[model samples]
Target: MSADESSQATALITGGGTGIGAATARRLAADGFHVVIAGRRRERLDATATAINVDFPGAASVIVMDVTSDASVREAVAGISRCDVLVNNAGGALGVSRVEDGDLAEWQRMYDANVLGTVRVTQVVLPLLRRSPRATIVNISSVAGESVYEGGGGYTAAKHGTSVISETLRLELNGEHVRVVDVRPGLVHTEEFSLTRLHGDQAAADKVYEGVDRPLVASDVAECVGFVVGLPQHVNIDTLVVKPVAQAAVHKLYRAPIDWKTEA
Candidate 1:
């Protein structure tokens, strides 16, 4: 919730504790934005902020926010004096239960976290964002938002809601100066993402990236965000879909061991 004395533009990232969120915080800080790293875990938020400050020196702040809560989002954004960029990076998948066997509670958790969470944060922060000459809102969605598989019904449905909202908001704010970007990433190999989705099954999580030649990392998506936000306000990238070379589509993936060290 802090900004620099220089009145630097502020970039607020929800779920900034780890993964692509943490990486985005660092990339934006290096690019000269006072980054507010917000998440539910104080330790993770502090760590991301500390890492940013190490190289950029007071370029980061931490806000403990649970995006699923209205009160939390309100209190968290209320403390910020200014917000030039908002990254809706919170929310995660809880399980992969098939449609017929889906747990109602798990479905609700996925929906609340991925869809409603984005809505809550954006609603409170719009006023501050309007103050900036060139404000930007980036929603970190997933390729699942665009497609559906057997066991991915709940997560995909929630992400589709996210995708729809981003599109709807962009249209609603047509004349407004704010830029809305929907970033969709596929097959990213992160420490906690698959593990959490598989309900702490480390073995299953590890299998998610097995034999894939360098599935996209957090930094890869972070770099995409950096580029999108850095662009001139006049040029708006409506939607960006990013995935590893091994993944041609959500259903298509080359999972064999790939050796790129030698000649083809």
Candidate 2:
């Protein structure tokens, strides 16, 4: 992979204040792409941009954006002229409740951020993407998007919409230079994802990954995004399902200590 150190290539990441988004911004910036990170928090965005600019000066920019709002997305995106890569990583789960007892409002927020938010941003950026010689849109979906579980009612539905959108858009954009990538990650250990979902219950969030060995980190997913975008525009990785060795599937997880020795 080569670096466009001239800052001609632009990659925009939503929910980029922290976690996977921030890591992706750093990786992309290191690869010589001008990175624009968008999120609702000004402070977090600034921190990420500052960190990136340390190594790649003048390669990081931040835009305050709320994906759920139309005006916010439009106004934020209007500042940039070209976008070669867009990473939709702005959404998160609210509650882990069964369908029978799920909170309707929580579901709404999930849909707005995970599903509709992608639509709103894509609608506005379609023209800009079309103009790019080699463009790719990466949606940070989840394992929940592929299959359902007992307590994943709202999140799963929303992510399923995200997964399908990636599928539909790929077909819709046939013959175009743009590539739609759906990155579904499983058992990623992140700072805010579970805390925000559990309403700031630190202990509960900690226990969610307790006993699991080497769960995927935000940077691990960032590495995936970096590799995908670095590939030739003609090569497309349609759907990538990422999980640690501890996780073989949604229902299957090894909680015991995993042996690291590789048999020769």
Candidate 3:
């Protein structure tokens, strides 16, 4: 909750106005990094920045940028003097339709946000990261990238592309001072993720966790990112998959109620 006098690392987190992005900003700020949270919404971004700065003092800032645009990302990074870490987390799913009934525009939007947006931000920020004493790039992917389901075609494909980006970057940046990490989380119950995916359908969003208990929260994934970035430069976490106990796999979720009374 307090700032560390010696913590000078600067981290730029995209989609940082809310959800996992906002949580990671707080986590990194608490870890003593000067956190810049970038997103498209000014209101949400300002709110998050204000909250973080309250806890960590002036450790938090906001950059209003659309990751999907080169000019926006360029402008956003222009003011960033140094960047020791980059967290690519600005992406979402649009709808739950099957492949046959998929919306082309929605699919393209997903691809642009999840895949190319990461590419743009990384490309522009590579120089800043390269200049750092030690740098880390954390890509926020999903277990859906590794598994398939009925209504997850577009999102799965996009996230798989994100996975490839993380993998290829790690290989390309080999022997460099930078560390590339891929964090894939499963069944996270954020306030807006499911709602956005369902296109503001409250009922549909609620059903996502209807019978589930203790689904992964945004802070859980944020903690993983914090831990990964906090490691020594010699350590590179290639890929990490985190899921709740209720979720055994992408296709298998334990929905039954817990029976606390039992014999050992």
Query: Would you estimate the TM-scores of all the predictions?
Result: 0.97, 0.96, 0.95
Cand. 1 Cα-lDDT: 0.92
The candidates, ranked best first by TM-score, are 1, 2, 3
Worst 10 residues of 1 by lDDT: 1-10
Q: Number of the top candidate by TM-score?
A: 1
lDDT string, candidate 2, 8-28, tens digits: 888989999999999999999
How much lDDT does candidate 2 score?
A: 0.93
> 98, model 2: CA deviation in Å?
0.9
RMSD, every candidate, angstroms: 1.6, 2.7, 2.9
Native-referenced Cα lDDT, model 3 = 0.93
| lDDT tens digits, residue span 142-250, model 3 | 9987888998999999999999999999999998989999999999999999999999999999999998878899999999999999999999999999999889999
lDDT of each: 0.92, 0.93, 0.93
Pitting candidate 1 against candidate 2, the one with the higher TM-score is 1
Model 1 over residues 12-35: C-alpha lDDT tens digits?
A: 999999999999999999898999
